[model samples]
Target: MAETTNGDARGASEQGAGEATNPQQFTIQKIYLKDSSVETPGAPEVFTQSWKPEARVELNTRRNTVGEGLYEVVLTVTVTATVEERTAYLCEVHQAGLFTVAGFESNATDQLLGAYCPGVLFPYAREAVSDLTGKAGFPPMTLSPVNFDALYARQRQREAASAESADDQETDNPG
Candidate 1:
């Protein structure tokens, strides 16, 4: 918390000229499971086979602005378990949250929504996936923690590289 020493009402606004007076803030208003599903096509047949199965995991994130300084971020996770080329089970979960973000520059805001918000939502999404797997009468499965910051950085790097390549191609062959 930051406190202003000046008591006068006008003193606050007079402190900074041509600058944003509001402090940066990021808050979570709500977190919930937007959607979830689990499938076991092999079912009883799968139970008869070996318990050793290979697991595949996928993750995605997206955001939308709903109001002034308010955003909705959704993290989707999918898991597929297979044994000997046969599908044991599949699961998908959409974990979503409403956040209030203010007093940040465009890039900072993007980082918050892209990396920080998804990080906050991941534990819930993991729990949902675990619950889904357990309810399907399979072993309790727990997903490893993800490094969203690294992922976001890599994505930004890829985008920058592609843009730079496009510019280079244009420079080489101007039409």
Candidate 2:
């Protein structure tokens, strides 16, 4: 006859127990503006005259592991407006988010950190920058859509090409 006891049942339960897990484990640890700055050196006087101002935007992204499974993603955007050599406004915003990312593959993690995370945080940063610029006496500067995935891919390609060139140089020298 088979043994029927609490110990056996407990052992069976332990053997058949699924891995400890929770569906709601992943979460956004926190979201904050890491850094932000807006400058309008030529504000009142700069905006007084009728001059076509040109705007330039530069963006950069960085990611760092904060904990065992937590990561921080930061997106930095710099916007500058100039009217024929005179500076109208300059704005820099750094938006950051802390996310708990467990059980994610490297590619997926990279995609989240590189593209999706930034996409989620950019709107708030844009709004803050626009408000700052407007409050600085310049017209509200609306940022355009950014294809972060394409940008990330382009950056990777450039890095790979540079590495290949470096490797080719090393191979040719063989010194």
Going through the candidates in order, what is the number of backbone clashes in each?
0, 0
After superposition, candidate 1 runs with Cα above 4 Å error: 1-22
Name the runs in model 2 displaced over 4 angstroms: 1-26
Strongest candidate by lDDT: 1
- Write candidate 1's Cα lDDT for 49-160 as tens digits: 8799999999999999999999999999999999988999999999999999999999999999999999999999999999999999999679999999999999999999
RMSD of 2: 4.0
Please state the error at residue 46 of candidate 2 in Å.
0.4
**Cα error of candidate 2 at position 32, Å:** 1.0
Q: Cα miss at 46, model 1 (Å)?
A: 0.6
**Which candidate tops TM-score?**
1
Candidate 1, position 167, lDDT:
100
Model 1 lowest lDDT segment of ten: 1-10
Model 2 lDDT-worst window of ten: 17-26
